[model samples]
Every structure is written in C-alpha cells, then in structure tokens.
Target: MELRPWALLLSLLLLPSLALAAGKCERLVITGSPDAPPLLWRDPQDPTHLIGATADVLQQVAKDLGVKIDLLYGGTRSLALDEVRSGRMDILADAPLNLGELDNLDYIHPALVQTDYLVWTRKDSTLAYATAGDLQGLKGAVSERARLTPAFDTFATQHLNLQRLPTLTPVFQKLLLGEVDYVLAGRYSGMALAQTLGMSNDLIAHDTPIDQPGLYLAISHNSACNDPWLRGQLAKKMTELAGSGVAQAALQRNLERWKAQLQQPVGTQTK
Candidate 1:
C-alpha cells in the first residue's frame, strides 16, 4: 500500500521534532565565586579566566560527558546562589548545601565532602580564642549570606560582634590590618588566599573548625538540563572520582603546589 502524501509530509515534519527531542547537546551554565580558591577563583594573569579545583572537576566531567560548559564568574556566594535559583545558571559548583525550603533545586546524593570554617588572624597579633564563644565582645568577620551551622550561628549571635563581608579576600585583609580581630573562613580558602596574597605566614589559621557541612553541585529546578540521567551521570562521575581517590589526589597536589607557590608568592595585588 502506498502512503498518503499528507501522511508522508507529517512524518517528515515530526521526524525533526523527534530528533530534536533526543540526545540534544546539553549546555550548562555554572556559577562560582572568585573568593573560594583552590575551589573556584579568577585567574590572576587574566581577569576573565577562572581556575581551581571545582573548575577542574567540572572540566573533567564535561570531558567525560562530552558536553560544553559556560563559566560565569560570580563575585559573591549570594549572587551565585541567586543565579542558580533564578535559572540563569544551570549549576552552582562548590556551593554549600543550604537552600532552606527551596525545593526548586535538587542536590546530588552524598555531597562531595564537608568543608569547615576556621578562624584566621595575623601571626603578630597575640589575640587568641579557643572557640566561637571566646570571641564575645571581639569583632569577627564572616562571608556575607554564608549559612553557618546552627551552633556557629548561635555563637555568632550571642557572643561575637559579627561583620559580614561579600568575599573572603577583604575579610582576610581586614584581619591583617586589625580592622577585625578575626575572620571566619574556610580553612582551604583561607590558606589559599593567604598564600596568593603573600600573607601565608602573616595569617595563622586556627586548629579548630567552627562549622562543617557537605558541599554539593546544585542544579536549578527550572533548568532544561535537569533530568535523572544527567543527575545519575554526574553522581556516578563524582563517586568514581571519590572512590578512585582522584578528587583527593587532585586536591592535595593542587594544595601543595599552591602552598609551594605561596612560599615564593605571586598576585599579592588584591582586587
């Protein structure tokens, strides 16, 4: 039997739609902060360039998945979170999992790992604090909009005179200049920034961690790329990286290299 002309035309038109619906190129926009270095940070030599651990991991994932990534430089954590929530960004890399009641976003299972906050101060300063409570009456700085664990938040509220800053660099600078007695910062970030700013020895990171939480790759609910297959792929890749020790090895090597460079120092100029 011969097919009708109308039916043949319809089939041809629907063929494109079917193809379009299947295996289309997955494009994703990821937002990251320049302050969270060795995790995410702007390249010093080139202001437009972004580089770090999260960046590296995402790059690897993109390679493995055979997809392209568009990187957007987000200056603040709040701005980054907003971009992701608003669907302006497909993913927010290295973001602390804290979307209180916002179900529009879904996080991958078993976060990459936990990150903790450290109290950093200049070495010359004799001031010391055993815990967040010890800072009562002293001025302290924390990342703006940073979701401190309940315990830390309570301590900050009850004891310390907390000052919120948009980014970690300024907070560290303030601590160096005695603008703030101490700055609550991510231990890795604090160390990286200190080295980058030629203040590694100048800034002393305390042994105690104030707060720790799992970090995740947050996907926007409205993102077109959000789907189970994509999520599974990402989770699997993360698991492989973790189980194979690829992530930890990369982190340690990068940290040591960063520390070594800090010994020599570069990019002391701040933005």
Candidate 2:
C-alpha cells in the first residue's frame, strides 16, 4: 500500500481549521435585576451567583439549545437594560416592554410570564379608595426609575404626592413603617418580598390591578447570534422546553411553594 503525500498534507492542514471552526461560541450573558426575587436574584451564599425563576427557566432553555449561560448581576432595572442595549449582555429575562423599545432587539412571542401592578397598604390602614386617582390626596410610593405603563404614568402625573423609591424593598419598608400611605408594586414580586420579609400579614395587596404586562426575553440587537436563523432556532428550542412541561411544572412548583410560604404564620422567618 502507498500513502499519498498530497492527501496527508491536506488532512494535516485542514484538521486544525476544522477544530477552530467547531469551537464553542462564547457563553451567553444573561443580565437581570438582583433584587427581583423569584424572577432574578443573586444567590445569598454566593453573591456572585444569580438564581431565580427566570434563571431556572433560562437554564432549561440553554440546556435544550446546548449552550452555556453566564449569569450577570445588574442590581437595578436600568443597569440590566443598559447591559443588553450596549451589547454587553446577550439577553434580559422577565423585562417589561415599557423599559424600552425592541425595534432593534428581538423578542420571543408568548412571553414566559405576565406581571401586574398593584397597590399595597397596611392591613388596618384607613386608606379606602379605588383607582389611581384615589391616591391624589395621599402620599404614595413607587419605584423611582421605573417606567410605569401608560395608564399608570398618566395617573401619576395627575397626582403630586407620589414618592418614588429606587427599589421595592425600601418601598415595602416605607409602607410597613407608615412612611407612605400606599406602595405600588408588581404583584408577584411584592408577594414574594412580603413572604420573605414576613410582612404578608401586616400588609395587604388591593384587589384592583393597575396594569398587566407580558415579561419577555430581550435579545441584544448587536449580538453576533442575532439573526433570523438564530432567532428561529432559539424560538424552536424555547417551544420545545415549554412543550416538555418542564418549565411549566417548575413554575407551578415555585408558585405553590411561594403561596404556601405566604399562607404560613407571619412570624415564620426565612433567610
């Protein structure tokens, strides 16, 4: 048998090229608010680590797509949105569209979650009212930099007593201490926080919903992975994840656990 010199040389030259071409892509950077509990938050034991509902769901999506995720912690909504907009991050989970326009960014249809804005007040507080207008005469608290839905914005504009805080925790604290007559909060987040702080018994959320918005995964427009083909592939993978009942089941379980925790006696504390 005779070995061909030309074939041997060609194989030697192409092997390295093939290996380089097949090298794995960079880790997908997912930016999220560290204080947004149950959706996205830093791991207590490991502050550098990020974990929550959105983290769990995104991990499942990445697993299905055979990609790696590098969770990045952005403590504020603005910071998280900035990271995605500046191309420093690949995706933002559980973000409201009111935060920014997605003309350049691509979004997944059928959002993973829906959020509602609501009012919270002390259980025995004499605040008796309905609609955002009812707060005109009383002091109210809300997220400082948060961009409320159009309706909420309009209502806030007409009311002059609204005081905006930087984060939800502080707003809840203010409400508990009677610093503010009421605090506007996102339903799920407020519930989670109330349970975590052992304040569910002291505070009660109003039945009226101020607004409801779908939460989406916003993919950066500048990402090299952004394109019709990549979008389609990701969408297909997400659909598969949803269809497998894994995401839904996990969501259900988390919701039930949170609910049970909320139902427990107020003195039951958690770290």
Top model by TM-score, which number? 1
Error of 2 at 59 (Å): 1.7
- For every candidate structure, what is the RMSD over all alpha carbons to the true structure, in angstroms? 4.8, 6.5
lDDT of 2 by residue, 1-271 (tens): 6769998899899999777645534468888777666666676546666777778877877777777887878656677778787788878776666434666577876666666778899998988768766777788888763536666677677764888777778989999998899988887778888877879799989988776666777788876556565567677766666557665565556655555645767655234
lDDT of 2 at 70: 79
lDDT of 2: 0.73
Winning model by lDDT? 1
The per-residue C-alpha lDDT of model 2 at residue 212 equals 68
Q: In order, what lDDT does every prediction score?
A: 0.74, 0.73
Counting clashing residue pairs in each candidate, in order, gives 0, 0
For model 1, residues 1-271, the per-residue Cα lDDT tens digits are 8989999999999998777755654787888775565676666555565666777777888889988987677656677777788888788876666658258677876566566688888888777778666777888898774556766677677777999888767888888888998888877767777777778878888888878766788888978788788888888887777666666555666677566545654455334
